[model samples]
Target: MDFDALRRHPDLEAPGLAAADAADRLILDESASALAEVAGPPGSVVVIDDAYGALALGAMDAGARGVRVHQDPVTGERALAENAERLGLAVDERPAALPLGAGLLAGARVVLMRLPRSLDRLDEVAGLIATHASTDVRVFAGGRLKHMSLAMNDVLGRWFERVDVTHARQKSRVLVASGPRQGPASDWPRSARDDELGIEVVAHGGVFAGTGVDIGTRFLLGVLGDAVPDAATAVDLACGSGVVAAWLARERPRLVVRASDRSAAAAASAPLTAVANGVGERVEVTRADGLEHLPDASERLVVLNPPFHSDAAVHTGIATHLFAEAARVLAPGGELWCVWNSHLRYRPLLERIVGPTRQVARNPKFTVTASARRAASPLS
Candidate 1:
């Protein structure tokens, strides 16, 4: 959406104030508004992340030098730069992008954040904030009231000295936190084990199946080890936190593994996971919708644990699009290995797109399937 559109849209204003204060800074999300209010006019340096770019832009408009840390190379880089330039704000020389726990914010004064959907990853960010921020730093966080959990408040309280909530504006509330003094950091234990894989997988709070590896992914991994025939180039479509691609790279050191996801947060975390697991040199991660940016027939194997949700609702269109993209990007004799909920009815769709799809394995929760792209038509 255009900047003018974002500013003028009623959805961007506080709930009751939209009509009365249309000319006021329009915040796209509730957390952003609360952050803007608590930070109280960003001075000197203002730190923001992908979730609250609009709020950052608002702060920049109000005379703050906004520094945005984005994980997604595509949207993150483009949006932050373009938005800052649009508002006639200066960009800082410090790194424009950072992984979730890279300890980059050593001297940030005011941090404005929008709570990410992945709660476990949020804890990691909290730990980093606790370690790096000084006592007087003001951290303003916000989210929809529906999404705010007491557990999150408790976690924030542990990291900051005092925490308070703003009244609901547009069905969303902002959290105000004062830092400088925080509880000692503690390590959360890993729950899943794959001794052969050599990775200790742990989930902190809000990751999907954070306590253990996902059953569908486990099934897919089993089939992948057997089905892939000397794969030299591989792509892990929807590579959340790089677990699948990391495992793939560890299993086949000679293969080039590429991981990608649509979420900016996932893109940031995936590369870190790869590097932490000693596969960073071999794995490349990017943020893109499906396989939009990759060339045709570029990879030998494309593994996917396709998602079934769009926002909060379950839908099949995402899986369908992923299959179409996989078919488009696989070379002749290239394979697409995918795991899906067994009840999702993907077998027929796979056959329609890739032709002659076959079931590779099955478990109570999911089905592993494989397909080879059909030979080109004679006309081509």
Candidate 2:
């Protein structure tokens, strides 16, 4: 398989951005033995967080069939499909992208994964595999050496009886684990009360800022009351854990609130957050690629705390993409309220992409801005 030929298109592609990396190659190489061991139906092999189609496609290229896959980012999901088509893999040879649930884990004899930065995220994946997968399942989790930690072995230890570290290769390593442990029922979708904000924060392991508000989100909340006071409907884009959507519904009794995110964890956590805050009926949660599911010129206002990174690499292109999406979704004269790192100086980009941008609030670390949709714009 030509891993180097894969491209991260439909994602932010730059000179340094890659569709596959050393960690991916190492994972494929390390999991080859287990791949040959997979038997029976197509679902016997499972892949998680495949950056593009490297792990899944590579496994398929190695002759493993019916690979079930799950990627948290919609961009990665699209990239995988595009790469598969580009590689000329047959329809039956392509991997099935599934959500992080029983269907993705059930009856799996082998699992390949890219180690997530969040230990909680890893814990969740490990727990699901332990509970739902075959007792003899062999797990191969790999990542760059810089991103690997001893704590991951501890997390896997909780779910599996043994975890063995593989020798380093090109700054990448893999953790092999077998012997699933039966434990107490899963304790996911954790929740905690935020007394200051008067709401409950619900989170699954993979969701950002699990069970708490980040400083940027906290800053956004402080000024949220003044965001488009007359608008009847609003959207919370990149809505992690749905803190903003839940807050909007509680503050504005008449406002229709929608929370959308690409992460399965965030999608699962948001509605729970709404229910915990007693706003479940008012907040609608959707797992989607940034407002792609939204109709053009359909929203009066949108709130965003756009992510600054594409995976581990810090890139401003993600925020720019969100700003453009916000502009497309907002009706003429509608507004986009956003919070970002002050140093990024997104005001100029916001002005160009959305409309006339104005500073809403600012501190040493963060800047909050409002941009209105132009009655006519170049991008629109």
| Model 2 quality (TM-score) | 0.97
Q: Check candidate 1 and list the clashing pairs.
A: 31-142, 120-205, 120-206, 135-180
Candidate that would win on lDDT: 2
The lDDT per prediction is 0.64, 0.91
Candidate 1 C-alpha lDDT tens digits along 1-380: 23452321211123332111211122333334434444443232344444324555655544444354643324344555555555555556222555444344566666666655556656766677777765466676666666668777777777777887766676666676776455676454234556655665544344455545677777777768875668787999988767798888888889888888776656656676677678889999888878888999877789999888643335676688789889999988788998888988799999898767888888788888888888778997
Worst 10 residues of 2 by lDDT: 33-42
Q: Give per-residue CA lDDT, model 2, range 1-380, as digits (tens).
A: 99888998777898888889999999888988788777446788999998888999998887788889999888889999999999888777789989899999999999999999999999989999999999999999999999989999999999999999999999999999999998876788788998999989999997889999999999999998898899999999999999999999999988889889978789889999999988899899998888999999999899999998887888888898899889999999999999999988999999999999999899999999999999974783
Residue 194 error, candidate 1, Å: 3.5
Q: Candidate 1: where is the Cα deviation over 4 Å?
A: 1-4, 7-52, 71-104, 182-192, 195-198, 202-211, 250-254, 262-293, 310-321, 352-355, 378-380
